[model samples]
Target chain A: MFEERLKEVQDAVEAAMQAAIAAFPQSDLRDAMAYAAQGGKRLRAFLVLESARIHGLTDAQAMPAALAIEALHAYSLVHDDMPCMDNDDLRRGLPTVHRKWDEATAVLVGDALQTLAFELCAEPVLGDAAHRIELVKALAVGSGAAGMVYGQALDIAAETAATPLSLDDIIKLQAGKTGALISFAAQAGAILAGADRAPLAAYAKALGLAFQIADDILDVEGSEETAGKRLGKDADAGKATFVSHLGLAGAKARAAELVAEAVAALEPYGPGAEPLRDAARFVIARDK
Target chain B: MFEERLKEVQDAVEAAMQAAIAAFPQSDLRDAMAYAAQGGKRLRAFLVLESARIHGLTDAQAMPAALAIEALHAYSLVHDDMPCMDNDDLRRGLPTVHRKWDEATAVLVGDALQTLAFELCAEPVLGDAAHRIELVKALAVGSGAAGMVYGQALDIAAETAATPLSLDDIIKLQAGKTGALISFAAQAGAILAGADRAPLAAYAKALGLAFQIADDILDVEGSEETAGKRLGKDADAGKATFVSHLGLAGAKARAAELVAEAVAALEPYGPGAEPLRDAARFVIARDK
Candidate 1:
């Protein structure tokens, strides 16, 4: 059921992305913009949609919020792939935006994507003025300089410095770059559903950590062919990773532990949280 | 009065910039962050302060908004001067951030600046939730992909292709890149004043054009020595400019006309608006 809903959300996200590009005037900007945005897994969108489903919210009701999350995910990827940053040449089996165009185009396209995140969030569909305000705050903290930006800073610093990073340092970095948005996806869904803070925050934190651990495990086991980019670049760069810090078996065990913790946190929501539980399992189990 | 008030606002902004950087953990991030942010014209800061003054607000009440605007301007300059973008080697008579540090550090610093803008705007000193919301919205639109980002995309595109851009096309591009924030500064001041829409918007629009024309005139007549950076690089790069299209004398005349028009629009405020009028004169008549 979670897999089926994920596919539905992916389709909605693809359509919304196409609609957003249509809003811009055509130029090289449109080409770079479309290329930068096109190929994400829409994992964030699914998290938003699935969490909304747990609240008994229909797809139509959750689509705008999901689209906003997808836009932000796409934007992060665009900036992350720039030559000065992560510098990846491929994403999801396609050339990254900077690899396809000059760096200027990629930067501009990324900026456009970031604005689209806010613009979509500001649309009146999600909730009232206060809810929209909360949503904007969440998005800003999740993706902005203080959160993801700080994480990227630490990632770059970690590469050059002689000091060995603690497990906590690694967790802190990933939490900002990857965890913040993932948590936002879940919390935004709960916010839309008007759920109480206890259940909302628990799901957000646990699921965010689970998602990050799954990503680490994938970096260790996945092939470049499968990942559509470099694999184990983390180890190559001597940046600490879950697989290196913990052996491959230990990493897998940790992932499972994280998923269990994630699912346990959803117990308060009872049967309404089945999709979120499935998602936690899927994060650890995915091949890509 | 304007000179003293501008200095006070500048000092406040300088303090705010230092405080923001001090909050980060000590690292090279601190050095790159400080280097990128510490110097600039403070034009955007002055705009906010001057606009507030026109609305009968004190500098103490306006400093937070001014700092926020300056942070946005500084971040834009940092990103724009990056090797991937403008490849500029100099800014404010100092080495560009990317030139001083690695390109990666420069990129991270720009991201930090972008985040800091929102952080400053969110400060309690900016007043209540509604006003904070207005400031955030204005900053987002003025600097984000749809406005300045869109303009920048077009500007880059314009450089790589085309024989000429029409005056209207140039105005639209300038409006997005330069005028958007200037307009935001004017409008944000009015919002803080609890002023009505008609006067606030009228002032914003006029100030926006006046500032753009002044920038054009500066590019044409200001010496590289006095301007603290390369001059006539716009024509050198084969990019279209207001001066190139209007010719030197014609551009100057048009700029003066814009200043007059901007001051005329402020007539409704009478004595409350004299500094803004002086600012317009200062804009078009400055030697550097």
Candidate 2:
């Protein structure tokens, strides 16, 4: 049931993002941007659409927000994969933006994609000007220095730190690195509908933590073919991750607990949130 | 007179920017961002304030937009100085962000600064929701794929192209690359006041073009001490620039004519716009 809904929203977001890309003139920057944003799980978009549904917003009303989040995610990935960052040459089973084109292309494409996301977020299709402003402001806060960038800076510093990060430090880092945007995605519908946001925010906090633990688990157990990129990077980098700090069985148990917490957070919506609950479960169960 | 006003506004912008950077946690990313945004003429911010003054808006009412434009301009320069881009080591006679920190820090700093700009633009300090929305949309349009990034892309592509760009192509490129943000800055006051934008828009177009021509002239005749960065780079790269296409004398004459046009465009504001007129002339007359 969740797979069907997920695939539907995924395809819709892909098309919407393509149309957004089409608004630009024909150029390599446009083409490179489209390519980087083309393939993704669209998990963030799904969170946006599903939460919007629970808040009485139709798919059409919620889509630009959905697309904006996905585009923003794509921009992060494009930069994260650059040579000066993760140096990853592959993503989604294809050459990364830097490898496919060049570093200059990757840099400019990421920059342009980010601006495009804000442009889309400001569009009237999202709702009234107030709602759009809220999204724009929230997204900036989630993605900017105090949030994702701070996490990234911490992660980079951890790389050469004299001591490995403690479990608490790693948790805090993961919260910023991966959790902020997810929380924003889940709460977007609530923000837009002028509805209470506590339930969705709580659900996203638990789900984002679970999602990162799942990724850590995958790094240990999954193959490159299944992951569609490099695996075992945590071990290779000798960096402290959930798996290294918690052990294999311990990490799995923690992920399961977080997933349960995530599901319970949605009890307020009852049956209407079944898909989101399923999404939380899928977060841990999926190999990649 | 221009230098005194420039000094006053530049100091103000620096303080505003410093406060904005202070909001983020202390980290290398924050440090690098503050460093990159530290020293410049604050030309864009001045344009915003000067134009706002013409529209009967006080500096207090327009300060957020001024700081936001400077942040956006700083992000562009940070990225443009990266290894894959211009690979500069010096800016304003200090080390560039990448040289002072690292490539990842440079990239993330630029990204965060861009996000910070949008966040500031959305603030209530800018005006009502409608005004903020207009500012957000125009900034996105001016900085995104069709504007600054596109010009940067064209520049990178022109580097390896078999043919040199024509005089017209370069002008069109500059319009997007350098002109877009300046136009946005110049029209910001009118947008906030809900006044006619035609005069400011025309003034900005000519000013932006003249600014580029002056930079080209500086590349030919200015020194490192005067320019505060590398000089003769266009000639060193053997790339077509305004000076290359139009000849040094012709480029100077063209810039003078553009300054005249820019000054004439502001005739609508009469004596209230003399400072702006001085700014236009300063664009061509200054060594840097």
Chain A of model 1 scored by TM-score: 0.95
lDDT of 1 by residue, B1-288 (tens): 766755666677788778877776566766787777886667678778777777777777877778778877877888789877788888888888888888877766776666666656656666665666567767777776667887888787777675778889999888888888877776777777767646656666666776776677777667777776667778678777788788878877887787777778787888777877777777766655
Measured against the true two-chain complex, the DockQ scores of the candidates, in the order shown, are 0.44, 0.89
TM-score of each: 0.92, 0.98
In candidate 2 chain B, where is summed lDDT lowest over 10 consecutive residues? B124-133
lDDT digits (tens) for residues A91-149 of candidate 1: 98888888888888877777677766766665556655456556766776777665777
Runs of candidate 1 exceeding 4 Å displacement: A52-62, A191-195, B50-63, B124-131, B192-195
For model 1, name the residue pairs that clash: none
Q: Which docking category, incorrect, acceptable, medium or high, applies to candidate 2?
A: high
**C-alpha lDDT values of all predictions:** 0.75, 0.91
User: What digit string (tens of lDDT, one per residue) describes model 2 on residues B23-76?
Assistant: 998888988888988988888888899998988888888898998888999999
Q: Taking the tens digit of each residue's C-alpha lDDT, what string does model 2 give over A40-73?
A: 7899999999999998898899998898888889
Q: Which stretches of candidate 2 lie over 4 Å from their true place?
A: none
**Which interface RMSD values do the candidates have, in the order shown?**
2.5, 0.6
